[model samples]
Target: MAAWQAALKWAGEHWSPAPHLHFVPAQQEDLPMVEALAREIWPQVYRELISADQIQYMLGLMYNVPHLEEEVRTRGVRYQLIREEDGSMVGFLGWELEAGSGANHSTALLHKLYVKPNQHSRGVGASALAHVIAEATIAGASTLQLRVNRQNRKAIRAYLRAGFEFEEDRCTDIGGGFVMDDHVMVKRL
Candidate 1:
């Protein structure tokens, strides 16, 4: 069986009803909330993987309200705020459909997938991933891809558990003297 299928099966056998989660599409008015969540989650998430300065720089570059709004308005990216059954926010996901070139198939680029540090190991990430995969499939994407920090072993393992195979290594310089050294992983739909 495929890794994702096996992972889903494992989740089914383990978590009785799974986590009651909701994915709310982010709007212009909702950008500030999304930014707030990022500010809260990033320091904890990247404390070990990156320096404080780099983290602050990245947050300012990627999670700033104006930048996020531009991403939604101009780039066709989709951002969703993940919430619980009680209507409390937990995490968020960001993705965009990339058009195919020549013989390549269209792909879904998972730009972000983050959960509160306290929510780890409770099946929130798995459920969120399953939702993204189903949504991407419904949108006609043949594959899903993402770039994860090379040093983020926890996230790397999670992606592997979800059937994403390592595709390549990329070292990108995002200005401000900071670099993103990541592993590009892909899962065929």
Candidate 2:
């Protein structure tokens, strides 16, 4: 059974802005569509850092279509799509809800946010981020947290403009000696 089915409270479905962009909760069928986008977004970076297996592993954890389906199905997390009226997904955002333990009330984690590189600098990212903050606020989140690669200064600036402040530095313990530099940031809602 789907998480929404298992739950007693039903969250609302779907939102639209200006007809050009629609914000909707993810469904199982949308995963492949999102994954295709991720494929375009993922390799632009990871292929330089490690083996193809690790690249695949990273994508699986971050963008596996079925994993996204299961996340929505189990309510561990949920994905949203920002689609054009013509039915193409222009951007995507997904997050972890209620993910932290103890005293972390109303907390959310942004897992992924991507818009095509061609869509850069034209408010595609801003639009998607605005939608994300709105959604998170609706979910009663007091704060939103996300990690970005320290190398991604441009994105860091975007996060800052979106009201996030640098929280700390982090390291992803991939295993053994491998670690990825991550800058943790959070925005209070």
Candidate 3:
């Protein structure tokens, strides 16, 4: 079976009434849809955590079509749109596998995982994360790591619930006079 198919089966056994989610690999033609979802999700999610200027700047840097295309086509990053069985998009996530220094060890960097505001509290996020974890494991990653803004308490809680522990604090100056004050979280596979 495909890795994700096994992951879905595992999720069904783990999460009650598991989320009927399908992870569709995003292509060049799908950039516009991903951008639209980002435009819709980021503001509502970061409104209280960061400034409007920062939000717009980060959006332009990360979600613009050209940048996304480059990340997918040239950078080895993988983007997947999360959808329900009924063919509605509910969320999206981006991830990439980073080779560790030695053989038999690697890390999966989860760059983005955002669900629609209205879908909060449902199993969509959890299921998506479970799927990623499974895929990473199948890909031989020994760890899964992500960065979450320090002030985003809700996301922090969710990560904690998913077995991720705070590893360290990071402040990255992503140009444009804006810095990301975040906590690096890691989960062992």
lDDT of 1 by residue, 10-99 (tens): 654464324588899998898898899999999999999999999999999999999999888876788999999999999999988884
**TM-scores of the candidates in the order shown:** 0.89, 0.77, 0.89
113 in model 1: Cα distance from truth in Å? 0.6
lDDT of 2 by residue, 1-189 (tens): 346332311311222224367777777787887888888766764555455776666776657777777777776677777777788777788887665534546788887888777767767677677777887888778888999888777687677766677899998887544566889999888
* Candidate 1 whole-model C-alpha lDDT, 0 to 1: 0.87
What's the residue-level lDDT of 155 in candidate 2? Answer: 80
lDDT of 3 by residue, 9-80 (tens): 454456653558899998889879899999999999999999999999999999999999888877578889
lDDT of 2 at 8: 14
lDDT of 2: 0.72
TM-score, model 2 to reference: 0.77
Which has the higher TM-score value, candidate number 2 or candidate number 3? 3
| lDDT sort, best first | 1, 3, 2
Candidate 2 runs further than 4 Å off = 1-19, 45-54, 100-104, 175-178
